[model samples]
Target: MKQVVAVTSKAQLEAFIDFPHDLYENDPCYVPELFIAQRDLLTPGKHPFHDHSPVQLFLAYDNGKVAGRIAAIFNKNHNAFNNTTDGFFGFFDCVNDKEISSMLFSKAEQWLKEQGATSIVGPANFSTNETCGLLVKGFDTPPFAMMPYNKAYYESLIGNVGLHKKVDLIAYRFGEDGYDDKSVRLKEAIVNRLKTKGIVIRPVVKKNFQAEVDKIREVYNSAWDRNLGFVPMTHKEFDYLAKDLKMILDTDFCLVAEKDGKLVGFALAIPDINQILINIRRGRLLPFGLFKLLFGMKKINGIRVIALGVVEGYRKLGIEACLYASIIEAYRKKKYKHCEASWILEHNELMNKALEHVKGVPHKRYRIFEKAI
Candidate 1:
């Protein structure tokens, strides 16, 4: 017999977090998320998102063995922002059995319907602002930092539940030797041109990070407003995320463009810590896990250009190219081998073209799915 149980106890919650470790045990490409981080993120008071939204975690068991897990999320902010009754399912993992997959979806759908939700959308662990989407097209390589990955069959399982494609997010790769020096020369001219307007690009200052972050928050909220599934992050939420990123933020790769003392653009890149995390063993940091993380930092060879934003008023001023050029320049100086600029909207031609201008090649793709209740 199969049964779906609400994760109401600590032991069950731990099991929920540990399920993926076993599910992907033999999959060489699987990179486990850190256990402690996952616990804190899902905990009510630990993450700021819980302050405004409600989430329920579930574990699916069959014949007394764990079969799957899912999170039923009721995003109050998303509903209020978009003025629609929508729910989300995230942190999803399952065995190959169709029955177990169906049971998990049924439990999530039931919970959302009880909350008066009219549609269910995701694979989003929390939201688009967080890690969302399923690896539908790219499975040969491990995922980049903060990206999602799953077995290819998981795509069929999701489709079996009637969740069709909502959108596809793209990831592009750039090799250290691949960028066109012509583009670099053009970017120099662009930077000089912008300087005439009192606009200059500089690295993020660690000492005055709070002020920089405040400016970034303003630009981030406004820049991505029109993206599909984007919901502006609250002040607290942005601050919370910024604090976490600051721990691994490399100043060389984190740059900002300012014009007349007003922040108009920013780009953030982080060392590809997945190179270290892959060895962390189910994302644990205790009992030798911390040693791997601490020592492995020095060996990381790649970067993930996770965010790049330019304000609406500042578009076409070459700020975007400058940000890309700066990152590439830093990567060259640091002797990094490659970088990934990721989770770009498939339809975002402007940004896509900007990446191609720097010789970025499309390497991986992810998809978000939605279905009417």
Candidate 2:
């Protein structure tokens, strides 16, 4: 018999967080997320998202043994922004059993239904702004930082339960020696031309990060408005994310294009810290794990270009090309071996073309699934 139980105690929640470690213990490519980070994000008072939204976690047990876990999320900001009442399921992991999968989805759907949600969609740890999507292709390598990964059989498991494809997110890879250098070669000329309009490209000012983040926030909120499933992040939410990324942010790859000191565009890439986290048993940062993370930063050989955007009025000014080229140039200078520009909406032709022009190979595809509640 299988039963789904809502996480109500600290011990149960801890078990929920640790389930994947045990599930994928033998999978060499599996990378466990940091236990502390996951704990804080799941706790109501610890993360700012909980202030305006509701998320419920669940655990499934077959008799006395754990079988799966899922999070039922009601993102108020997302609903209000997109004008749709949709709930989401994230942090989803389960054994290869149809009965257990159905039980988990049933529990999540019932919770969302009571919340007045008309539809449920995801695998989105929390929201699309965070780590979302289920890997449907490319199971050979581990995911880059902040990306999601799962067994190839997950597609059938979720599909059998009635979640249909909503959209596919693409991940492109650029090897250190394989990318087209045209963008890099043209970057200098583009910057010179932008200078005629009082625009200039510069790296992020680490000493003045708060001020820089404020400027970039405006552009970020406006630029990605049209993207699929995007919702403008609240001030508190963006600040929280900025603080988290600041720890791994390298100024060399965090560039901004400014017109008289007003940020109109930006791009940010982070070291593939998953290389280090993959070895941290059960995602614990204990006596030895802390040391591995501290010294692993210098050994990472890849970067994940997590974000790149330009405000509406600044689009088509070659800012996007310049930002990407600048990063590639930096990648070469630093001798990083690989880079992944990812989670791009499949319908985003302009950005997709730009990456294709750079010889980026479309290596992985992730799908977001939806089902009416």
Best by lDDT: 2
lDDT of 2 at 138: 93
CA lDDT of every candidate: 0.90, 0.93
Candidate 2 C-alpha lDDT tens digits along 41-76: 999999999999999999999987899999999999
Report each candidate's C-alpha RMSD, comma-separated, in the order given. Answer: 1.1, 0.8
Model 1 regions lying over 4 Å from their true place: none
Residue 38 accuracy (lDDT) in model 2 = 93
Q: Please identify model 2 stretches exceeding 4 Å from their true place.
A: none
Q: How accurate is candidate 2 locally (lDDT)?
A: 0.93
What would you estimate as the lDDT of candidate 1? 0.90
Q: After superposition, how far is residue 372 of candidate 2 from its true place, in Å?
A: 1.2
